[model samples]
Target: MMLRVFVTLKPSVLDPQGMTIQKTLAGLGYSQVEEVRQGKYFEIRWAGDLSAREERDKVETIVARVLSNPVIEGYRIEWPQEIPA
Candidate 1:
């Protein structure tokens, strides 16, 4: 049982950092990459007693309330999956 929170900017909003990276890539001759957008990624580890659905909901609640700005940003939870051994 773990909790994960993923926060990202809304699609309509501009991501300056992503734009810079894309430009830099093009300068390096990587023209095949047409579009690039950046967002946040995080992996959180919490207790093991909570169910997957419960954990996701918990994160969702937090994201909606505080972690994410619904007007300018979005958030989603990651489901349980195998960890590398």
Candidate 2:
């Protein structure tokens, strides 16, 4: 099984890098773009025999502790739609 994680700045936080990209896009004539936010993506593959619930719990812990800063960043987990039998 594989799970995907997305770590991003909270909406209330400032994103200078994202702002810069948006400005550049306007300069490049892509003015239709309204906003751009920067973030990190992680893919975790599970090979253990753990149950789906256990796997999610483990990944959630890792994400909260090591993947993102709880103060300024938020994270979401994307579980696979189907598990192989």
Candidate 3:
């Protein structure tokens, strides 16, 4: 199974990296750019007999507790396919 994790800063927080991208795009003629926020994206792949819901919950928990800084960051998890026995 493949797991995709997105770790992002909270909306209230500022993302310098994302801001840089936004400015660059604007410089490139993307004048419509209004805002930009950047965060970390991680991918983990595991093959196991665990259910998708169970695995997803696990991943979320890990992100909330360990991977992400709740003070300024939020996290999301994605699975490409359901677990099969």
Name the best candidate (by TM-score).
Answer: 2
Clash pairs, candidate 2, are none
Q: Top lDDT: which candidate number?
A: 2
Model 2, span 1-85: residue lDDT tens:
7778899999999999999999999999999988999999999887764356776678778999999999999998887777432
Of the pair 1 and 2, which is ahead by lDDT? 2
Q: Global lDDT for candidate 3?
A: 0.80
User: What overall lDDT goes with each candidate model?
Assistant: 0.73, 0.87, 0.80
Answer with 1 or 2, whichever has the higher TM-score.
2
Q: Each candidate's root-mean-square deviation in Å?
A: 4.2, 2.6, 3.1
Candidate 3 residue-wise lDDT, 14-82, digit = tens: 788999999999999999999888788988776753475686567667879888999999887776665
Per-model TM against the reference: 0.73, 0.87, 0.75
Write the residue-wise lDDT of candidate 1 on 1-85 in tens digits: 5546678888889989888988999999999877788876767666643455565567667768877788888887765665321
